[model samples]
Target: MHFKDLFVNVSETLSFTTILLGVGYLAAFIVSVLVISENRSPAKTLAYLLLFFLLPFLGIIIYYVFGENYRKKKLYRLKALEDEKLQKRLNAYVYQRSEEKLKENELQLKDYEKLVRLLTYEGRFPLTDNNHVQILINGEEKFPVLFDALENAKHHIHIEYYIIEEGFIVDRLFDILFKKAAEGVEIRLIYDDFGCSLSKKFLKKIAEANIRAVPFYKIHIPFLSNRQNYRDHRKIVVIDGEVGFVGGINLSDKYQNEGMNNELFWRDTHLKIEGEAVRSLQLFFALNWSFCTDEGLFFQNEYFPKYEHAGDKKVQIAVSGPDSDHASIMLSYLSAISSARKCVYLTTPYFIPNESILNALKNAALSRLDVKLLVPGISDSRFVNAASQSYYEELLECGVRIFRYKKGFVHAKTMIVDDVISMVGTANMDIRSFDLNFEVNAVVFDEEINQQLKQVFLEDLHQSREISTAYWHRRRWFKHFFESMCRLLSPIL
Candidate 1:
């Protein structure tokens, strides 16, 4: 063991370590170049670059699984193709009527022509006038109507939910579905593999009851697949082509306060539609069903039955995802905000907005319009809450009033604009909903529904505590820093 030999070994070890570090950094730089070349949002590009350089190995794994935009497009390409094929068939029958309906509602929708035109130009989203829209406040209000509709289902039941947790509500739902199936009604369900907690035993029961259930983008190996990011975050139910449901509420008992699992009072929003608008929801379900099981349920008469003037309400369903040509839901929000004449009130469980949305809100407030945001006082994710809080100071400073629901977790993704337009659906006001997930929303152009939603928003304000700019700025320095850090990393969250 000579000292010269030991010194030589030490020098060799240092040389090896330096080479490894250099190689790792070089790989990170290469990936950063790829990320930037993808033409992604600036915030997202910066987030990926920071992750790559700071935590090269783990960041590479994350980017491999989640950051690859091409993988998402490839995953949903088939669905998009199938949708285009079906949309043509729909246009032959539905689009013509939609155009006529647009003309019929032109007087009421004059202020929102840009929003309507934006959505209509995106294609497949039709504006229907003969829709009977009902605002269901929470699980308590929604479940009864939904169960009644399920019980009255004559031909078939089509349901697609992001989450289907096992609980009393699900038990009741299964009972109705089983009975309906026994009565010769066709039943099909699509649940998100990433969102559902259904076990093998529960699935066996669904199969035994003769209900065809499939998972969206089945993840064979959890740690390997990128399907986790591209989720079907939609909650929709179309029964017999006459009744439809859409909103943030999932098939979980947590959304209901009367259930045995009602530990927390959960606040949410859902819509029940009984008219031509239900056909739009049916189309969305058919697309997902076809993607999951290759079952083309399009152009079926039973799924797109003719309506006889269910009501005078005008409704349009807006959907967006990675497969979409444009971010339709976000555009709808931005349009709604910018077009607002009197006020814009938005309620969402998540509040991580991108640059466009943030600027839109600030500009709206700066224009002397009443722009208010209602978020959760008690959040399920601390990091998300912090990230959401980071934007509050700026919004408040811009004269945009912010409120935190103190009564419960406000899980409603809703927006009311002026006196003639409103939105309720599954998309949150966050990056995930804007870019990563499949989301659908009902943009109602009826004054009655708008007033109803406005009333609900006003009631919720009573339960929420307004955030003052001074108070927000007075938050602890460490918390401000922590939330800023979270905001910096929010693009990936």
Candidate 2:
């Protein structure tokens, strides 16, 4: 074989390979474009196209990271419409329930009206005298309150959370539940499989005690689907028919202690609503149970028992999830902001705002409404932090006051308007909380409750340092670019 013979054979093979690759690339490109265009924004469509052009293989992988949902926007819209219908039905029922008591609770008429409208709009457990709300701040406040409620469990104790750990805090809570179960207290625990997988053994212990510890939306474990998209981000503990808990706090030691787990001094907030609100929380739990277990859990005699409005505060519950397209809780937040006469004070661990929320904040500031934002001094999510910080300059320029909580992390998700009506619960100021994640937020209207939340907010505020417009302008341009990019993807994120 001479050099000339070898060159001819190799060149012919190379030509054939090139042609095959080109044809394959074109096929994939066309398929991806067709698939992506079905539901994505124009910007996302173009971003994807450019990526595919630059690196076909890696671009597809990135698509896999973000290109979920069969037809996200379409599905979202359908869910939203269905939710709207549910909202109307729910509102009617609530109004009927409250209208009867509206005259009795006449002094709190505006509060009741707000509660009914907010609950109806948000699909929160319709306000009932049989339910009550207990505002549980940190672990010091939540644990003792929750433990006592668990101890008093009668017919059943329904528990569901996004994160359930096996730490000392969880162990203590589990022990109380375990002993209560032995004493004829029915206990059903549901934790998100993905979120609580780390505590599988602890969950197993509950199962071993003849208690139901079901993993929701579980993967690969026989019955459950691996869809892994929607999760039970809600944290609610319903004890019999009289007591309940809902909010940001999870069943984890880190949230309770200085224990570290990728995050330091974990800060989060939660609610303990007894009385009629507990029934609403229980209803929310039942709906989730129906979705996950396929068992119809109507508020039958088994679940419903006699109770009264143990608390005087006018409270409304708001819930949002993948099942609902309207982003009800987020809408409620916007409503609060829009109606805010003097100030809008909000605190969250994550501050990544969606376009509508971002625009609302900007406009609120521009309108000269006192807008103060509180976030962690040390953030757990850098990308989210950058995205949050990205809005500082414009906000500050428009007279918005920003504060970084010097305390470890401000996980309390509270939003107060005119410093009168305050909301405290699991919902954060981000698209994830607004649109993607399941969340529960409480709306409190009574002056006393408002003052209580305000005092706590003020104490937290004392620990926060104001971020000046000058300081915001000093941030690197690259950071701004990254945040802006992150903001663009906020819708899908």
Which regions in candidate 1 have their CA more than 4 angstroms from the true location?
1-17, 78-89, 92-95
**Which residues of candidate 2, in runs, are more than 4 Å off?**
1-37, 40-55, 70-92, 98-118, 121-132, 221-228, 258-263
By summed lDDT, the worst window of 10 consecutive residues in model 1 runs over 71-80
For 336-419, candidate 2 gives per-residue lDDT tens digits of 777776788888888877657778888898898988888899887777787777777877888888889886777788887774
lDDT of 1 by residue, 1-493 (tens): 9999999999999999899888889999999888888888899989888888898878888988876785334567535345676557756655566667768777877788888877776746678888898999999999999999999999999999999999889999999999999999999999999899999999998999999999988988888876778899999999999999999999999888865556678999999999988987887787777778866556668778999979988889999988877788999999999898889999999999988899999999999999989999999999999999999988888899999999989999999999998999999999999999999999999888989999999999999999888887788899999999899889998
CA lDDT, every model vs. true structure:
0.88, 0.71
lDDT score at residue 449, model 1, on the 0-100 scale: 92
Shift of residue 260 alpha carbon in model 1, Å: 2.7
